[model samples]
Structures are given as C-alpha cells and as structure tokens.
Target chain A: MIEIKDLHKSYKMGSNSLHVLKGINFNVEDGELVAIMGSSGSGKSTLLNILGMLDEADSGTYVLDGIPIKNLNETKAANYRNKFLGFIFQSFNLINYKTALENVALPLYYQKMPRKQRQEKAMKYLEQVGLKEWSHHLPSELSGGQKQRVAIARAMVAEPKVLLADELTGALDSKTSYEVMELIQNINDQGNTILVVTHEPDIAQMCKRIVHLKDGVIVKDEKVKQVRAKVNV
Target chain B: MFNRDRWKEILEVLTTNWFRTVLTAFGVFWGILILIILLSAGKGLENGIRADFGDIATNTMFMWTRSTTKAHMGLPIGRNFNYKTEDVETLWEKFPQLRFISPRNQLGGFGGNNNVIRGLKTGAYNVYGDYPEIIQQEPMAITAGRFINQSDIENKRKVAVIGLGVKNELYEAGEEILGSYIKIQGVNFLVVGTYKKRSGNGNGEEGQKEIYVPFTSFSQAFNRGNNVGWMAITAKDEFPITSLKMGIVNEMKRVHKIHPEDTRAIGFFDLYEEFNRVESLFGAMSFIGYFVGILVLLSGIIGVSNIMLIVVKERTKEIGIRRALGEDPWSIRKQILLESIFLTIISGMAGIVVGALFIYGVNALLDANGPVDMFMNPSVNLGVVSAALFILIISGLLAGFIPAQSAIKVRPIDALRTE
Candidate 1:
C-alpha cells in the first residue's frame, strides 16, 4: 500500500531548473496491481522513482505501509528499501559476474541469511519463475525474456511488501512481454502489491488499475478491465 | 576470518581479469624482491670487508717510528728513528690506559724470515718476539701447550710456540711435539705450545705460518739490540683510540727527542679509526639499500593504487547493485580495500619467498666456494624481513585508501542510472 500528497521534484540543468514532477497525488491499495502511464518528460518515471525511495520528492508526504518516507538517513532508507520494496529495471540489472541463482540470493545475503538457506530460497523463487533449470546460468547466457524472468525472481525472492517495475517488458518481444505480464499478473494474484510503469496501452490494461500522468500531474485514475496475457505454447 | 563466499567472489573477480591482476601484482613482486636482495647483498658485503680485519682487536693501535719529514729541536729532516724497550716501559708508566702494550720485534727487526726446523722437516716463517699480551690482541687457538709467559721473558728462556702449519711440517700426525725441541735460525728452542690464529685476512694458511718467541729471548739471541720495530697497544674500553695514538705519538716525540711538528716521524695506525671508517662505509651502503628499496616499493604501491582505481571504475555497476540491495557504504569500501590488500599481500609474499630462495642459493654458492671477494654469507635477519612484511601490509592499505573512497562515494542512483 502507498500514498502520496502534493509531491514535487525538480532537476537543475545549469542556469535553469526543470520542474519534473509538480503537485502529484496518487495511491495504491493492498494487493492491487497498478500501472502508471506517461510519455517522455511526463514525470511518470520521476513519480515512480520517488515511490521506489531512490529519489526524494522536493515537497511531498509519501506514506508506504503507515510509515512516512521523509528525510530518512541513507542507512535507514537502504534498510527500509531492503525490507519493504523490490525493484525491476528495464535492463534487468543482474550482476554479470554472478549466476542467476546467486543474483537472486544477493538481497537475502544483505538480509544476513545463511548462505545455504539463501541459495535454497533463491532456487525456490527461480522455480516459481520457471527458471530453476537455468539457475547456474549467467545473465549474459540467458535470452531477454529469461533475463527479465531472472530479474523478477530476484525481485520477489526477498518477498518485499511492494514491487516496483519500471518498464518491465520494454526490451522484450510482444509475445515474451505477454509472458512476463502473465508472470507479474500471477504474482499479483498471489496477494502481492505491484506497480508497473509503462507507456504501452496493452501492458497498462493488464493491471487492475491505470493512472495516467501529464505535465507532472495525475490526469486520470480508473479501474482497468483486466486483459489476461495469452500464454503461447 | 575465511569466508568462502567472499573468497569465491574475489577469486571470480580476479580470475575473470587475470591479465590485469598479474600485471598489477608484478609491481609489488619486483619491489619486494629487489628490497630483500639488496639488503642481503649489503650484509654479504659488510661481512666480507669485516673478515679482512679478522682477529685484530678493533681497539688495537700499531705505532711504528719512521723517518722524520720535518726537523725541529736540532733534529735534521730525513732522520730515521726507532722505539726501544725502555720507551715501551716509559709509555706504560705514562699512560696506564694502554691496557696491553707490547713492543713487537720480528726476525732481523722487520720484514725478515726465519726457517723453523725439526729433524729433516723445515718451513719458512715470519717470527715475532712478543709479550704474552700479544695473544690477547691476535687471539690464537692453542692446539697443544702454553704461549710465551712472564717467566720466559724474565729469564730469557729459549722457548717457542710453534704454529699449526709449523707443527704439521715438522712433526708427524698425532706426534707428541709439546715440550719437544725445534730449531729456529739454527738455535734450539723447546716447543712450549702449538697454536693457530683464530682468524685471518682472507688467508688462513698465512696465519698458520707464524711462530712466537719470548721478546727478551729474541732480542738477546737474534742481536736485535734495544731496537723495537713496531709497538702495538690495545687500550681498555676508553676508545676512539685515535686520540690515544696522538697522545702516545706526542709523548714519543718528547721522550725520543723528535720534532713535535714532524708528521712523518711516526707511522700511527689507529685500528679503532680504521674500524669506524669501515663501519661508516657499510652504514652508507645500508642507507642506499634502504633508500632505493623504498623508492621501488613506492612505485610498486602506486601501481597497485592505479590498478585499484581502474577496478573501482569497472565495478561501478556492481557496486550500485549492492548498494541498491542494501549494502552499506562501509561495506563497499571494505570490499575494495580487501581486494587491494589481498593483491599486494599475495604478490609480496611470493616475492619474499622467491627472494628467500635466491638468497639461499647465494649462501649455498658462497659456502661451496668458501669466502669470495667482496661478498660472504648473504642473509636477511628474520626480524627485518618480518618488519618488511608488516610495512608491506600498511602499504597495501595505503594503496587501497583512495580507490576505496572512490568506491564509497559511488551514488546508488547515479550508478543505477548508468545503462
């Protein structure tokens, strides 16, 4: 669950400041799958970044699971991010030196889990993504869809309260994108709260709710008619 | 302390870029190797030079009379002079600080030869008529009997202490030669002892060719008169014997009636000053060894630092991922620092091992060949080597510092943004 009130963010470019996000307000409830949609410079990514706690909103009240995420120290913020949020980047940022299983186990390692149990739990998540057979494979060795799957496994392995995916299927083929969305949909059905950031209408429709942004402000919020991903062979 | 996962990570990172690792390590390897070798070689050089002054007490001063180069007080230039037995007594009374003062008289005075004979066996030797104190100055490893004693000098006894070489030449192996008679210059003298010089100036055989007789007996029998060829005096610990030599020389000038300003009137050889000179020479050599070693080590550590900088740059993404995964800045810093230190220590250890092996090889060669010119028994003290390793560890940490700071300063957002 997340809440924001009058969030603002700006970027300084030499002599001028670009107001990226201005007076944005949004919310997502428990177990709700939401998609935030906007074109380039529309501030959807900025809003998502603020929600991910990777960037601070200049003037806003952000509440995630009843804790006001404001002005936390670096250490406390990192701990909160580790405990409460999982992130999936467009590029599927799996450390190239580590195998898929090791990548999935990384967050658990920071959690101070014993190496053996971490690997076991990572293997379980890998199996959940249908990637148990490729656990030992490197990210470079995997296809685009499989890499995204590995990233998804890594994201959910820690079982964080919120999952934030920024353009999760942006680099995949349409068919592979459908499969990744189906996996995300399945994860959301298991009662995990998820937010997908995408500009694609079909991907936005796959979520239970869609929030549209323009000029750094939310323009529309509506319950979406869920379109299930057709699982191809 | 041994974490298998951390070790696996380090090994993977290092092995993935094996070429760069070895290249980086070479700097430290060569540095430590040269450091050890230079130190060991310096030790060898010191030992070799020290051997040249073997058995001669460092505090001993050899004073001999020479021709006067400048005349004063009615003494003409080019006047030859010699110290006598009475002067030795006078010197003793004047300077009681002279612990062992002995006037040495060789065959025909100085630079003379005397052939020793026992039955059909004969060996040529440089004979010395010396006091019992001579044994203290140039220690002899007595093999058979006693040396020249007070009674022999007082009574002018015809007793001789033959050298080991003389004993070997004249007597059969295991022969009872002590108390036996030996003929020197056709004069029969009873062999009171057989001795060998404990050390030599790179020539053990030469030391073995010497023989000692009572000074009184030598002066009386060889008609040496009252003329002493040279005087050797070893002072009681009040040293920098150069001042003592000057005092004695000035005293001799007053007693012997030579000119005070005549520099060439006495051949003053200060063993303490000579030893000091040699010591300072070796000190300079050691300083140079350390100076050059530090410079090389500096460059090597700099190489390590440079490589660590590049490594940090290359791993920015991985570091960002770790940060995003909730790793602290301190953890990132520690990781980079550990890697740098590991590289230095492993490579440095290898260098030390190889350097030790090389030194061992040199020592083996030296042993096989006996004492060589300008080099002997190259070795490094364990404490020094251990201290060197300790210094290397600190260097490793220092080399890692800047790179680790760079790693710590990497912003998670900026690094993640880097596609």
Candidate 2:
C-alpha cells in the first residue's frame, strides 16, 4: 500500500516561486489500477515523480507499507524505489544501446545478483511480455508497442508492489495504446498496484479508480467501472 | 556488490571511445619517450666529454720548470731555467709517490725535420722518448705495433716505435714499417711497431707525431747532458700529490748539493694544482647538465598531468552512469587511477628499454670502429634506472590526482541529469 498526505512542493525560478504541487492526499491499495488525471501544468507528472522517488517533495508525509518516506535521503530513496516501487516513464526510457534483456536487467545490477541468475530472470520476464524472440534487439529496432512491453517487463521483473507509470501510452497510437493498456490490465490482475498518470479520460476509464487533480490539488477521487481489456486476441 | 563489475563498466566506456583513450595514453607515452631520450643524450654527452680528456689523464700531474738561475747549467744570471736528466732521476727515485716518470728533453726535438738518407732522399720525422708505463696513464690504442720494453733499455738497442704519421712519411704507402729501419739524427733505428693517433682525446699534434724510443738511448745519443725541458708524473695512489711534489723538490736539492735556502739554483711546477683547476671547471659543467635534465623531466610530468585532466573532463558523463548503476565511488576512483598508472608504467618501460638498447647499440658500433675513449659502453646504473621507473609511476599519480578525485566527486543525480 502507498499513502501520501498534505504534499506541497515548490521551486524558485530566478526569484519567482513556482508552485509545482500544492497540498494533496492520495492512496493506492493492493491489486488496484488507479489513474491520475490532469491536463498540462496540472502537476500530474510532478506528483508521479515525487511518488516514484525520482524527485523529492518539499513537504509531505509519504508512507509506503507504513514506512515514512519524507526523511529518506537520495540513496535510501533510490534503494526504496528499487525494492518497493517500479517506474515506467512516458518515453519508455530504455537505454537505447541495450538489448531488451539487458534493459530488463537494469535494476538487478543494483540487486547484487550473479550475472547468470540476473540474465535468466530477465529472460523469464521478457518471455512473460511475449517479446522473448526480440530479447536481443535494441530499443531503436523495436516498435513503440514492443519497447513499452520491454519497459513493462523490466518494471514487473523486480516484483515491486507498486508500478507508477507516467503517460505509459502517450507516445503510442490508438491500437498500440490499447495493446499496452491490455498488458497493464494483465499485470495489475497479477496483484500489482499500478498508478498511471495520463491526460485522456478514455485511458483513465480503463482503470478501477480515477483521481482528478487541478493545480496540484486533488479535486476528486472515485471508484470507476473496470473497462474490459480490448487488445487483439 | 560492485568489485570487478565497475572495471567492466570502465572497459566499456574506454571501448566506446577508443580513440580518446589511446590519445590520452599517448600523452604519457610521449612523456616517457622524451624523458628517456633526454636522459640518454645527457649520458652520451658526458661520455664524449670525458673521452676528449682521456689523453690528458684525469689522475696525472705534469710539471715543467721555469727558467730561473745564476748560471746553474747555462751562463745566464736570473734567467728562466729548465730541467736536466739528473734532476729527473733524483725526483723519480726519491719521491715514493711518483709512480711513473717522463721528462721532456726539448720541444724542437722532431716533427717534419727530414732525416736525410744520402743527403737527397730525406724522410721527414719526429721522435719521443717515453716509458712503457706511460701507455697505461692514457687510453692509448696500439695497432700492428708494440711499445718500448725493458730489454730495449738494457741493451740500449737503437729501435723506435713510429706513429702512423711517421710510418706514412718514411715507408712507402701501404708498406709495413715494423722491422724496417729508420734513420734519426745520423743513427739507424729499427721500426719495432706502428701506433695510430688518438683523435677523440683533445691532445694536439703531440699525440699524432709520436715516434717513441727507449728513454735511456735517447738521453745518451742526444748529448742531453742531464738537461730536460719538462717532466710528468702520476701519484702512487689517489692521495694529493702536493706533499709528493715537495718531496721531489727536497730530493732535487740533495742531488745538487745546494742549501735549502738556495732557491735560485733551480725551478719547479706543481702540476697537481693545475689538474685541480681543470677538474673544478668540469665539475661546474656537469652540475649544469644535471640541472637541465631534471627540468626536462618535470615538464614531461606536467604534460602527463594535463592530459589526465582532459580525460577526466571528457569522461564525466560515463563516470556518472557507472556510479548510478551501483558502482561505489571508490571503485570508480580506483579504475580511473589504475588506468592512469598502467598507462604510465607501460610507456615508461618502453622508453627505458629503447634507451638501454640505444646505449648498447652505440657501444658495439664504437667498440668495433676503434677505441671509444671515455664514451665506451656508456650505461645507466641499474639502481638509477629503477629509481627513474619509480619516478614515472609517481608522476602518473600526480598527473591523475585531480581527475580521479573528480570521478569520485561525481554526484549520481547531476550525472543522470546530464543525460
């Protein structure tokens, strides 16, 4: 479970204070697919970044599995991010030079696993994403859908409790986007909690819950009907 | 968690930018090469200088009497004086420290003066009377010849050892002068040997025009009448020869039966004093050479350091990636530092080996051509070479210090942002 309360973040841009995130509260439970909805400048990505431990909040009480994250330093936050939460950025963020399997092996480099074991585990995860035949292809050689599948494989390989994906389908066309949503639905069904940030309501309607934000404030948080997975058989 | 994996990362980075890596290492390579060449050249110069002075004999002392008198041997009052055979003998036997003795009879003895055979076919020549022991005092090389021996002196045999110049002028070209007869001062002396002149030593025509004979024979035949123009000597050991010079002076007084206060009867020179003067001059020159060598080494080291700085600056991004991927700062620092030291050691060895081979090459070439004089088989001492290698390693560290420190200081956030 992940929990946040009274999150406030700000930055000074040449003497003018930019309020990137205002006060807010949010939560994600086991096996939930939640969507964070906002338009541009709505603090959705900033909020996701703060929750993913990629950036810090100026003021907040973050409780991940009942442990407070506000006091965690950079290294410790990275550690927590590695162990408890997996991140997927809008761009897929695969290191362009690495193959699919090697990209899946990124977090394991920090896990201190032996090379052989890490490769085998990464291969297994790639197989689960149905991209096992493309394991040796670099991101540039893979389609947008295939690259996102590789990123999801990498995020899920570590068995983290929370998958915080920021605009996971932002760069894919409609068909590829549905395929990615279907893959995300399958992953969440496997008992991982996912919090995806996107601007489109059609994408948000696919999740079990939706959290709407306006100027960094949580305007609404409500349970929604689960849309059936519509990826091609 | 890190260990050798960090090295793998570094190797990846190096391979990714292969040209940059080699260029960085080339800086160290060039530094070592220049260092080695400079050092070897300095050694060669010192050797060459010593060779030029080889004939002058580093440990020898020469003394010539200035003419001063009230009619001791000639009839001039308070005129410059010269030595006599009696004075030489007295000096040789009395001063125990005087190892070898040679007293010049006169300067106008020989050289281009034709010894006429039948008053028409004149063979131009020069002759010197020297002891066999005098050969050991200088680096004199004998070619197809022999020096005078004790037997020649005992028999007073009329024989001469001619230089190449004398042999060429007297005997027809390409003719062997050994066993040939040469007439000198109305006397036929057998040519027992032929010697080549030493050009590397700074000795003037005196070295070229030597036609040496048994000293006793020359002393007797020339009607020298105990008169010598100058004398040279070596110390029994390396101790100062001043006291020994005084001992000779006292002996001279005894031989002439003159009172100690009767200084007007004879004159002497302190060649040891002259030798010291020349030695001090060389000492100063060698000091300057050493100073210049050290300065060159320091500049080479600076070049290495500057190269390392550039390498660190260029690789900052790669350093960030490594640290982000679970690499400890220590490992990053170690990899960069090891790369630097390894580069220096390899290049340093290349320099040293090439430098050493150069020395040996010159030694063999010179030993074959002729006598090498002071420059023969010039070599750097083994201990000194090892010390130089150690200095190279230390120079690597100094060159890489700032870069390695920067690698360690790379913050993961800043590095990733540099993405």
What digit string (tens of lDDT, one per residue) describes model 1 on residues B1-419? 26677778878877888999999899999999898899889999998888767767789899898888887788788988889889988988988887888899886322444467788777678788999989889888888789999999999999999888877778899889888998889888988998978564656777787889999999898988998989888888875577788899899988877888878888878889889999999999878877898789889999999999998888888888787777767767877778888889999998899999999999988888887877888888997689778978899999999999998787787878866
Among the candidates, what TM-score does chain A have in each? 0.98, 0.96
> What lDDT score is found at residue B336 in candidate 1?
77
Error of 1 at A118 (Å): 2.1
What is the DockQ of the complex in model 2?
0.12
Question: Model 2: clashing residue pairs?
Answer: B67-B80, B67-B81, B68-B80, B68-B81, B83-B228, B84-B226, B85-B226
Across B1-419, the per-residue lDDT of candidate 2 in tens digits comes to 24565556545655666676666555555555555555555566566765666565444566665444434433455554456776766676666666777775532343555552322345555566665676766545678768888888777777887776655555677765688776677877887887776676444555666677887777777776556656677776565676676666656655544455556554555555766675675566545544664465566656656666676776675555444343456655767776666666766787778767877787788878976545544566676578768877887777677778876676654554564
- Give a tens-digit lDDT track for model 1, residues A1-233: 79899999999999999999989888889999999998988998888888877789899799999999999776777788888889998889899989999999988988878999999999999999999999999999999999999999988989999999999999999999999999999999999999999999999999999999999888999997899986331
Model 2, stretches more than 4 Å misplaced?
A1-7, A22-34, A51-53, A59-85, A109-115, A156-163, A188-195, A205-211, A219-233, B1-126, B131-133, B149-159, B173-176, B180-190, B200-206, B214-419
Per-model TM-score, in order, reads 0.81, 0.65
Clashes of each: 0, 7
RMSD of each: 4.8, 7.6
